[model samples]
Target: MRYSILTLATQALQKQQRWPQIIAPEKLKPHYDIIIVGAGGHGLATAYYLSHNHDINDVLVIDSSWIGGGNTARNTTIVRSDYLLPASFALKNFALQLWDSLSQALNFNLMYSPRGYLDLAHSDGELEHFMLRANAMCLGGASASILTNSQIAEKIPALNLDQQSRFPIRGALFQAEGGVVRHDAVAWGFARKSSEKGVHIQQNCAVNKLLTSNGRISGVSTHRGKISANSVLVAAAGGSERLMANAGVPLPMEPINVQAFVTEPIKPVLDHVVNYNAGLSYLSQSDKGELVMGGATDGYLSTARRGSFARLEDTMMRAAQIFPFISNLRLMRHWSGTADIPMDGNAIVGRTEIENLFVNCGWGYAGFKATPAVGWKLAELIADGKLPEMLKPFALSRFTDGALIDDAGIGPYPWLH
Candidate 1:
């Protein structure tokens, strides 16, 4: 059902029980034109774009678990495009543009809030580095500006601005277009629209191995049965490495655990997403008034979905340093997601060594923000048999050709990325 003001009134009058399911479970198909392994945000969004944008509806999205129950459900929900590199800036900026109208296009309320983003710097040198990034963002046609310490103080009065404090606020990089969205809503919206457009979504069906008939394309062997497809895309995030390895193509990516959590509800105290660059932590406030926050990855290699309280304590300490009020709030919930960190910090998003196989992992913590753009471009790549220009920089062959787009200058260290 299409949601609107009238639909709300009508449903209210009928006791609100007539609303239909967002997406219906589908039986395994014998074959499909395209098969996407992983029904997370990128997978579902790709299915929707394939049917909606490219008129290719014969697509199957299979997941071992329920849709959006993977990394899609385990994120801090922050979105932004203030990247320093040109290639990274273009892709993310395109995603940000799509985000402005996605809720309406999908006929679902994403609860997107353009509440701005503040990257706090602790020293003059750090502020200068942010200025370079801001310049790059503006060059790519994205909005960004520098904020002095006084400006940040006026903007976020709840922040701890004591000059004597360690890592005191010196300045920040502010972007008006960066903010948060309802993460689950993004997955559900795409799944609903994709299902409505005749795309098959099979949940609880794991793709165990990649079945290639020759040096070219073939199909996948799922838990249910063998399903043939003309092409396959492994956008499975953490699972991409294993699935691609089944095709004899080892991915230059490693899965690492990243954690995030929220605090007890309170009256609104934060209006913008704040990143403590010095402390390597970020935070924002949800609609329900919960302070959503996170820090760096686990700094090790692991695929486990659970997080250690030790890391959570470290993140909480960082948050308390900047937003002292958080020290008084009780922890409501905490969880971790497996991040597929590529050799280079940039995402890998193009064809693999296998003829008909493509990859779209290595997004790390930035996957949630790049969902729409990746979907739109990956669908174009499959339907048109040519990679979109925006995604060429993320090709898997870049590593072999020494064309690595290392946006973070973090080298090929997956754990550091």
Candidate 2:
């Protein structure tokens, strides 16, 4: 039997089927200074920042399964800040800064490769949009270099240089800070270090409900028991909606399944992290020398994270277009993970209706790149009673406050998924 290797998630109905453990009522903690209800990258990262930055160590990082096993481990693992918004740039900047220093911070070799990221353009308007975004990046103090087709060819000679195709590579806006990380290592490192610092890293603990008191956040009821808290931060990506509904504040979220596959270990043919500039497709290479490739969800809604036959067909067509040698690669493994899509293709990182309740979700497919920043500001929000400058704009009230943070300007479809 061909066994699937996707694991590392504790609570991501986004991809794997993780069963929440059944707690027997007595094993719960009666109270904690803070309780973060998600053990994914965002949740665990939040816990790390809370303990390390905010000195809130009497905390717990509980997952339905295990830390970083969710979206954190299942990504194509490209980190970039080529977004078209100010807020995104700021958050990404912080995350990039953290990634640059993550090896030391987590005390583990994360295998972070600054191999560069490229957004290929196919037409004049597409090229124009790239420049506009590049200009936006310049204003944000981020180095976004615009490379011509010739420079692109020189930087990546493996691409099919033919000028005619459905989506041809015209030019690219390369971000030097952008790269790939070993997703599982980053997660395990954070979990390892944070546990050493005395934060209870509980696996197999799934939160079943959010206990409320007098119209404020109180605690979480888990399968292992209950942990009361002065504040709660919900960073569950795929499980965000279901958990929020327990608190009576349902943020608009659609669980979309994104599929990714790694080819049988091939000699490195693709160099940089290849980005689908026209849309949401992106490809990269693993340290083991596998040609890892993936793209957007099929613009449909489902909690299921199974790979569809259609996605394999769609991505293979695009891959062959970029590098004809990709045709010789064999499919080694295939799996799909969950992504949360809000009405707008952006993240929600602020207050919910419940006073002590907060959110760091709806990241769509782009949250992994902003992990460190999200963890920092979310820890601040959980520590201080106010929103920080970086996370202030992405508040949940945006939808009702007549404000929206639609970065890429992709409408409700979340094509960036």
Cα deviation at 384, candidate 1, in Å, is 0.7
Residue 353 in model 2: shift from native, Å?
Answer: 1.6
Q: How many pairs collide in each candidate, listed in order? A: 0, 9
**What would the per-residue lDDT of candidate 2 be over residues 116-210, giving only the tens digit for each residue?**
99988888888898899999988888889889988988878888868877777778889988999888777777776666666776777888988
State, as a TM-score between 0 and 1, how close model 1 is to the true structure. 0.97
Candidate number of the best TM-score: 1
Report lDDT (Cα) of residue 111, candidate 1. Answer: 88
- Using all chains and alpha carbons, the TM-scores for the candidates as numbered come to 0.97, 0.90
Predictions in order: lDDT: 0.89, 0.80
lDDT value, candidate 1, whole model: 0.89
Give the poorly placed runs of model 1, Cα more than 4 Å off.
none
